[model samples]
Target chain A: MNIIVCVSQVPDTTTKIAVGADGKTIEKNGVKFILNPYDEYAIEEGLQLREKFGGTVTALTVGNDSSKDILRTALAMGADKAVLISDSGNSDTFGIAHSIAEYAKTVVPDLIILGRQSIDYDSFAMASMVGELLSLPSISMVSSWTINGSSITAERDIEGGKEVIEASLPCVISAQKGLNNPRYPKLPDIMKAKSKPIDAVTGASVPARVTTVSMELPQTQRRGIILNDSEHDITELVRLLHEDAKVI
Target chain B: MKIIVLLEPSGNSIKRSSLESITAARALGATSIHGFMYGGDANSAQIAGEYGLSDIAHTPATEYSSTAAATSLAQFAKSESASAIIVAANAAGKEIAPRVAVKLEAGYIPDCVGLALVNGLIQGTRPVYAGKARIAVSATTAMSVYALRPNVFTARKAENATSVNVRTFTPQLSESDTRVKVTNVIRNEGKLDVLEADIIVSGGRGLKGPENFHLVENLADKLSAAVGASRAVVDAGWRPHGEQVGQTGKTVSPNMYVACGISGAVQHLAGMSSSKVIVAINKDKEAPIFKVADYGIVGDVFDVLPVLSQKIGAVTGK
Candidate 1:
C-alpha cells in the first residue's frame, strides 16, 4: 500500500491576526507561522500506516516557496518523500484542491489523507472535493480506522453521533481530533530533515471561483460586568439574566 | 430565481438546520423554493411547506453514500434550472455540498452566518481564522451554493399555508459512486450534542478531577443544555473528545455559553467568541476568560457552582 498525506502551513493560534491594507488577506509581518495543528495528525497517521503496511508515505503541500517549512517538518516526522507544488498561494480552496487532485492523478496512490479542515479558512470541504475530482470514496472527521486486505472500516463523527463507514482501497480519509497523538521529531532527526530533498514542481493555475470582498475584525461588545460570588451578587445576577439579558 | 435547499431527515421529519436553510432561501427572495431529500417520501417532507417550500423532490435509497447523493442533488438542481443551492453546514451537508458544487461547476461557500442578495448574486459573511475575523465573500460563478451555519438562522414558519407539489425521480448512480457506504450508525443516547444545543455548560481544569464533573452535568441538566469541556479536561480523560470546545476541537456558536472554572486561551476563545451570551465563573479575577465574557463571577467553582445552580434552577423551575 502507498499513502499520500496533504499538509499546510498556518499562523500560530496565539498570534493576533490583523487584516492587511488590501482588505483581503492577513498581515504576514510579525505573525509566527507553523505547521497546521491538524495536519500534524495527518502526517503522523500516514507514517504509522506506512510503518504497518510496508509502503512509502509521501507528503504533499501546495503553496509558495515559504511553505516548504511544513514539508521539512513532515520529513522530520519520517515521511519518505516531500513534494511542494509551488503556486502563488493566493488561490481559493477549490484551486488548491484542484492542484492536489492533478498531482494525485499522476501518483495514483492507494490512500490519500488530509486534515478535517484548515483552521485558517475552516471550509471543511477539501477531502470531498478531491474525492469527487478523483472519483474516489471520501470520509471526513474519521476518529478510528481499520483496514483488512482491500476493505477499510472507519468510525467517523457526525453531528450528534458516529457513523461506521465501509470503503475499499484508493479512498480519501480526513483526520479529525483524537485520531492519534502525534510524535515530535528528535533533535537529530530535525537536523537531518533540514538537509532532505524537497521536489518543487510548478502548480497549474486555476481561476478562483470565490473572491473576498472585504475583511474586518469581529466587533465584540461584551458588557464586562464583573461581580463577586456573594449572595447579593448571585441574586442580582439572576435578576439581570431574567430581565436584562433574557437568556435563561 | 429557482432555489434548491437540501433537506436532511431526522427520523420522520426534516432536521431543524435544514428547515433553517429553507428560511435562508426565503430570505434570498426566492419565490420558487424546492426541498430535496435522498431517502424520504413527499409526505414526510410536507412540513417544508410551512417554511416557504413550494415544491418537494424525493428519492428512495436504502444505503448512504455521499458521492451518489451529491450526483443526485446536482442532477436535480440542473434539471430544475436552479440558480442557487442552500444547505445547512452539518456533517452530511458539508460532505455533499462541495461535490455538488464541483459537479455543477458552481462556486460554493460554507458555514455562512449572514447572507444577502447583492445585485442578483448571493453575498455571504463568514468567520475566518476561527472567529477572530470575518470576511464578506461572493461567488464569481453564475451558479452558486451556500451552506448556512446551524443555530444562526432562525427558522420562521410562514403565516399562510402553501400547498407543496411533490415529485419523485430515479437517480443516475454508478457502481463506483456507491462504494463508500454507511454500515451502521451509533447515537449517543439521550444526550444533546453541543453543536445543536441552544445553551452549553462547559467545564475546565479548575474542576480538578473527573469525579467532580457531576457539578457540570448537574448544572447542564437544570438548564437543559449540552455538556462541554475544555481541551485540558478532555486531554486529562475527564470527558470525551466530542465535548471539547476549542481550536482543534469543535467550534460552537450557541445562544448562551456558560464557562465554569475555565481560563480562556486564545484558541478556546476562537471557537466560541461568536456566542450570543457568554458567562464565565472562575476563582481568579484576572483569568483571560473574563475579558470576553459578558458576565464574570470571581470565586472558586466548588463554592460558587452549587449556589449558582440552585438559584438558576429555582428561577427556571427546572
Candidate 2:
C-alpha cells in the first residue's frame, strides 16, 4: 500500500495577523509559520498506515519557499518521501485541489490523506475536490478509520451524531482531530531530516476562478467589561442580556 | 440575476444558517430567490418559501453520496442558469460547494460572513487564519458559489409571501458516482447538539475531574442550554468528543456563550470567538478567554457558578 498526505504551511496560531500594506494578504514581516496543526494528524496517520500496512508514505504541500520547512518536518515524522507542489499561482480552492491532483496522478497512491481543512483558508474543500478530480471516494472529517483487505470504514462527525461510512481502497480520507496524537520529531531525527533533500515541482498553476479584492482586520473590541464591579450584579446581568444585548 | 441557495435542514425546517444564506442572497439584490434541496417535497418548500424563497427545486431524495449530490446540484444549477449559489457553512454545504464550483469551473468562496455587490459583481468578507483576519474576495466568473458562515448575518424574512412554486427534479445519478456510502447515521438521543443550540454553557479543566461536570450540566439545565466542554477536558476523557468546543471541536456561534472555568486557549478561541455574546468566568484573571468576552467575571468557578445559576434561575424563573 502507498499513502500520500497533503499538508499546508500556515501562520502559527499565536502569531498575530496583520493586514499587509497591500490590504490583500498577511504582513509577512516578523510572522512565524508552522505546519497547519490539523495536518499533523494527517502526517501521523500516514506514518501509522505505513507502519501497519508496510507501505511508503509521501508528504505533499503547496506554497512558495516557506513550504519546504514543513516538508522537512514531515520527513522527520517518518514520511518516506516529500514533494513540494508550487501553488499553481491561484487562490481558488479548486485550483489548489487540481494542483494536488496533478501530483496524485503521478504517484497514484492507494490512499490520499489530508487534514479536514487548513486553519488558514478553512474552506474544507480540497480533499473533496481532489476526490472529484481523481474520481475517488472521499470520507471527510473522519475521527476513526479501519481497513480490512480493500474495504475501508470511516467514522466521521455529523451534527448531533457520528456516521459510519464504507468505501473501497484508493480513496481520499480527511483526518479530523482525535484521529491520532502526532509524534514530535526527536533531535536525531530532526537533524537527519534536515539533510534529506526535498523534491520541488513548480507551476501546477490552475487559474484562480475567484480573486481577492481587499482585506481588513476585524474591528477591535472595547476592553472587556468585568462584571466584578459594584455596578454589575447577577440580576442586572440577566436584565442587561434581555434589554441591552438582546441576545436572550 | 437568479440566485439559488442550497438548503440544509436543521431537523424539520431549514437550518437557521441557510436562512442567513437566503438573506445574503437578498442583500446581493436578488428579487427572485430560488431554493434547491435534494429531498423532501412541497411541505419543505413551504418552510423555505417563508424565508424569501419564490421557487423551490425538489430533487428525488436518494441515498446519494456526497459526490452524487454535488454532481446533481451543480448540473441542476447550470440547467437553471443560476448566477450565484450560496449555502450555509455546515457539513454538507462545505463538502458540496467546492465540488459544484470545480465541476462548473466557477468561482468558489466558503465561510463568507458578509457579502456585497460592487458594480454588479459579488464580493464577500471571509475570515482567514482561523478568524485572525478577514479578506474581501470577488468572483471573476459568470457563476459564483459561496458557503456562508453561520450566525454572522441575521436571518430576516422576506415581505409579501409569493405563491410557492415547487418543482420535482430527477437527477441523472449513476452508481459510479456514489461508491462511498454512509451506512448509518447514529444521533445521540435526547441531547441538543452544540452547533444548533442557541445557548451553550461550557466547562473546562477548572472543574478538576469528571465527577464535577454536574456543576456545568446543572447550570445548563437551569438555563435550558446545551453543555459544552473545553478541549482540555475533552482530551482528558472527562467528556465525550461531541461536546468539545475548540479548533478541533465543533465551532459554535451561539447567542450567548458562557465559559466556566475555561482559560481561553487560542485553539479553543478559534471555535467560539465568533459568538454573539461571550461571558467568561474563571479563577485566573489573566486567562485569554477574557480578551474576546463581552463580560468577564474573575472569580473562582466553584465559588461563583452555583450562585450565578441560582440568581439566573431566579431572574428567568426557570
Best by TM-score: 1
Give the Å error, residue B278, model 1: 1.5
Query: What DockQ does every candidate get?
Result: 0.80, 0.66
Query: Candidate 1: which docking quality band?
Result: high
Candidate 2: Cα lDDT at A101: 93
What RMSD value applies to candidate 2? 2.0
Instruction: Identify the candidate with maximal lDDT.
Output: 1
Task: Write down the worst ten-residue block by lDDT for model 1 chain B.
Answer: B38-47
Question: What TM-score would you report for chain A in candidate 2?
Answer: 0.94
**Residue B183's lDDT in candidate 1:** 90
Q: Write the per-residue lDDT of candidate 2 for residues B1-318, one digit (tens) a residue.
A: 888888765557767887888888888888567888875444655766666677877776646467777887888888889899998888778778888888888888888878988888888888787677888998888999988878878888878656678887677877657788777888888998898788899999999899998889888887789999999999899998899997778888888899999999878887898888998988888998888888878888887787778777775678
lDDT by residue for model 1 over A11-62, one digit each (tens)?
8878899999899889989999899889988998999888888899999999
Predictions in order: lDDT: 0.89, 0.84
